[model samples]
Target: MAGSNKDIKVAVIGAGALGLVTLKNLLEEGFDATGFERKSYVGGLWKYTLDETTSVLPSTVANISKQRGCYTDFPYPDDTPSLCASSYIDDYLQSYADHFQLRPRIRLNTAIRAIKRDDANNKWHIEVAPTASASDADTETITFDKLILATGTNDKPSVPKIEGMDTFKGQVLHSQTFKKPEDFKDKSVLVVGIGSTAGDSAVALMGHARKIYLAHRHGAYILPRLHNGRSIDHGLTYNLMTVQKLMQRFAPNVATNMFTKFAQKIQDTAFPSIHEHPEWRLSPAPSLRQTFPTVSDELIPGLESGDIVSVPGLKRVTGPNSVQLDAPKEGDEPMKLDDIDVILFCTGYVNDLGMSLLEPRVHPARNTNPAWLALPGSRGKPLARLYRNVFSLDYPDSLAFMGAAAFATPAFQLYDIASMAVAQVWGVEAHNTSTLPPKAEMERHVDEQHAWILEYARTGPVYPQLTKQFEWLAWADEAAGTNVGANLGWGAQGWTFYLRNRRLYKLLTSGVYTPHLYRIFPSEKRKAWPGAREAIERMNQQLEDELKTKKV
Candidate 1:
C-alpha cells in the first residue's frame, strides 16, 4: 500500500527524544505529522518531574558516552561533559527540537485518552485531552492515517510488592519519586535492587543519609563509566558491533568464549572485590548471558568505604522500620535491619502495553497465539509482539512503536533508523510493501526471538526490547534499505566498497563508530548529510586527544 505523503497524516505520541526523531523523520518524508506529549514539557523521562513519570535520579549521568548518546545529524555540543548529567541530556533534546523546528507541531500538556482504529476505514481515531483535565468528556477526537507510539519503554515505574510494606510507617518511595539527597538527610535508608538507579541513588545519598543499605539478591557486574581512561562506549564495545555480528554468525562457540573472557576481564578491572566479601549475601556472579551489566562508577567505592551497606535479599518486614533479611550464606543466621527511616526501591520500569491509552483490540499483546501469550516471568503481561521491536505485527503498515527496545549501544540512532524504516514502508508501497515479508513470517520471527529471550530470562519479567545491538541494527538497516553493512562486506557490494572508499571504510571499521556514521551514505529513501564525515572525524580526534592525556 504505497501512498503519497501529500495526503498521509501521522500521529506521534510522546515528544521525548524518540518521539521527536520520529516526527522529524515523518515530516522529512513529506507526511503531515503531529506529536502529542502528556507532560507539560518535552524530553520524556529526561525531564525530571515530581509526578508519577519515571525520570533520571538527581545524580544520574550518561552511562553511554555523549558521542554515542547523540542523534545522527545533531552531535552534542563540544563543551558537553564526557559523561554528561541528566540536565545536559534534557537540554540537548530541547535543542534538537529547536534545531529541527519541531516545536510548532508538538502538542504538550495533551494526553492520549483513548485510541481506536477504524478497521473498515483503515484509520486511527485518537481521543486526546488536556493533561490536567480529569474528565473523559473534556476530550477531542482526531483522525490519522498512521500512529507512532513514542511513549517510550520507561514511562511506567515497576514497583515490587514487598511483604509487610504496609506496616513500614517511616517512608516508602520508589526511585521515580526520589527527589533529592536533602530529602533523606540523617535518615537510615534501604535501597532495594542493584540496577543503575540503585547504585546512583545509593552513591548520591552517601553523605545525605545517615545510613544506606544496598540490598540485592544476586551479584551484579557493575561496570565503571570509564574503561581504559575513555568512556566504555567510545572504545571496544562501540567499535565491535559489526565484528561481534560477524563472529557470532560465523563462529558462535568461539565468539561466545571470547566475549565471555572479554566481559570477565572488564568485570575484574571495573567491579569491586565485594563479590568475595564474607558478610554480604550476594549470590554467585552471573554470566553476561544471564543479564546485562549495570554501569556505575561510585557504587563499589561507596560499598568499600562503608558509606553504603550491602545486604542480602529482603525477606519481609519484621516490624515497623525493621526488615528481616536472608542469611549471608546457607545455614547462616538471618540478619535483621532496623532503624530504617526510609525505604527506596530502585527497581526498574515496566514496558507493558496494557495501559488505558489503547483499546484492547489494538493492544500490543492482542495476538491470540498460545506461543505469544506465554510470556516468561509475566504470565499475562501484555507485550507488543512487534517484528524487530518496531512494527506492530497486527498493524505494521499503520502503527509503529519507537524506542521500544533497549540495547547495549545508544538509542538515538537506533530509534532514528527505526523511524526511517517506518517512513519508507508507509511512504512508498514498492519500497516496503512489495519487499516486506508476509505477516506469518514476521510473526514467526517474533516468536523465535521471544523463545530465545525466554531461555535466558527464565525467572524474571523479560522486557521485549532486551535485544542485541548488532541483530537489531541489522534488522533495522534491512527494513530501511540503508545498506550500512555494505561497507563492512556484509551486503551486496561485499568488500568492494571498502576498496572503492578506503578512507570512509577505514573510519567505519576502526574509528569511534559514532552515531553520525548512520547518516554517512544516502539510500533510496534517506539522504546523507555532508557533515557526517566531519562529525565522525571530530569525534575520532577528540578520542585521540582524550587517550593522550589520560592513562588507563
Candidate 2:
C-alpha cells in the first residue's frame, strides 16, 4: 500500500495536456507528485467532449499555433486570436490547471486499475478504481517510487477492420465519436480518413450534408491554417528539430530533393487541388514526403456546389444503401457509393492505452508493450521499447513516459522536456550513480531509435518520438541535468557552426531566431529566463510583425 513514508513519491498517469504539464514539471522538480484524471475536469484532448474517448472533431481547431500551441508557463491571451478555439484550447488548459495550484494535486474521478511492480519494494503497485464503481467491484492498491505515463496519444478509436465492418447498415461514426455536425443534419455522409479528422470532418459536414463523401486512401497534405497570413507552422514546421539535423547534413538525394521541394512549394501555394494529384501522393514508395499534411482551417469548396465529393478506397460493404468505390482509372469500374446515409470513421486513436501498464520483468515473453509499437508484422500495432522514447528499457528507474513523442513539439515543450528528464533521472541516485546511462547505453538508444523509426516509418505514420524539438530537448538536457540543455546556448561553437554553413546554419537557426530562444529553466543555477529571453524576443518580433501585416 506504499505509505510507510519512505518518502520518494510520484504517480502521475493522465490528467492530459501532457498530464497537466507533467504535474507542473514534477511539482517544479521537488517531486512528491500525484495526479490521475479520468476526467471530471482537466483538458485532456482539450476537453469539449461528446466523449467517445476523445479524439476531437466538430471542426476541432488549434491544429498547433496559438504561438506554437502554447504552454511553457502560459501565453495565449493577447485578446486571444492567433488561431484559437477547441474552446480556446480548453480554456488554455483549464487556465493551466487553475494557474498552478494544479487543483490540489489532481485525482479527479480516478480509474487506473492495475500498474503492478512492487518487486520486493522497488515500488509501484497502483491499481485504482472509481469511475463510479459501486456494484460490488472495488480496487485501490497504491504504491509508487515513479511512474509517469502522461497519457499522450489520443486514446481509443483505431477502427479499421473493414470487411463488413460488423455488417454496417446505417449510422456508423468514430472520428472519436465526432462531437456534433448536427449529427449529420440532412444526412448522406461517408467521411473516412486522411485525418485532421478527414479534412475537417468534410468541411464540418458541408453545411449539413445532403451529399458529403470524402473517403481517401492517399493524396493528403491538406495544410493551410493561414499560410501567407502566417502560422502554417511558419516554414519547415517552424523548426523541424533543427530542420532534421540540418537536413541530416545533406546529400540524401540532397536532403530529399531539398525538403521535397520545400514541401512542393507549400503544396503549390496552399493545396492547388492537393497539388494536382501527383498520382494521389503518399507514395507507391518513391520517398513519400509531400511535406506533412492533413491540416485545414477550412477549404473544400469544389464539386461546383453538388456539395462535396472525393471518394476512393473502401471497396466493400455494398448494401444498407451502398459503398464500393476503389477502381476509377485502373480500368475504371468499381464505383457503387449510392445513397449512404452516414459512415464517418475519421479513424485515428490507438496510441496503445498505455499497454495495460506494462509488465516486462526481463522478457516475460517479450511484449515490450506500448500496445505493440509495431513492425515485425503481419500488420503491426502494439509495441514499446523506449530507450529515449523516455526511458523504460525494461523498466529503468521504474517506468517513465510523458507524451511519448512530440509530433512537431510544443505539446508542453516535448512533455516538459521529457518530464524534466524523468526528474533528472531521479536525481541520479542522489549524487552520481556513475552518472547513469548504461543498460547497454539504454539498448543502444532503443536500437538507434528503432532503426530511425524503421526509416520513413515503413509507410505508416505516428513515429514521432520527438524528431528534434531542440534536439530532443538538448538530448534531455544532456542525459538528465535538466537545465534544458543549459538553455540551448550550445556553444562548443554550435558544432563548429554546424560544421560550417550547413545551409546557412540551417536557414539562420530555424526562425523565431534560434529555434524559440530557450525556456526550460528549472535551474542550471538560474541562467536566463527572467524576461524569458526578452519575452520570446518581443513575441517573436510581434509574430513577424503580425505575419507581415496580413492583407491579401
Best by TM-score: 1
Candidate 2's residue-wise lDDT over 1-552, tens digit each?
332222568888888788888788667656688999877887777767776677465357776777666755567767777777687788888888887888898888887766778677788888778764533257777887888788777775666666665666789877777778876789898887666667777887777778887776655545567777677665543346545656755544666677556655765686565434443433332233312456675644433344667767676876776888787457878777779988888766656646555565632215543433554221244446676676677667767776556554456666665665676566533432213478998788666655665555555554444343445655766654534333333666456655764754443455543223335243442233454544555566777777677652
How high a TM-score does candidate 1 get? 0.93
Worst lDDT run of 10 residues, candidate 1, spans 428-437
In the predicted model 1, the residue pairs found to clash are 2-429
Best candidate per lDDT, number? 1
**Residue-level lDDT tens digits of model 1 in 293-394:** 767888878878899999987788877889988887789898898899998888776675323477887777666445534645443445567888777888
Q: Cα lDDT for residue 346, model 1?
A: 81
True-vs-predicted CA distance for residue 273, candidate 2, Å: 6.3
Candidate 1, which segments miss by more than 4 Å at Cα?
1-3, 237-239, 250-254, 275-278, 281-283, 353-355, 366-381, 429-435, 459-461, 490-494
- CA RMSD of all predictions: 2.6, 20.7
133: Cα error in model 2, Å? 6.9
Error of 1 at 317 (Å): 1.7
Candidate 2 runs further than 4 Å off: 1-138, 145-147, 156-169, 175-189, 192-212, 215-261, 266-292, 295-308, 311-338, 347-401, 404-420, 425-428, 432-552
TM-score of each model, in listed order: 0.93, 0.33
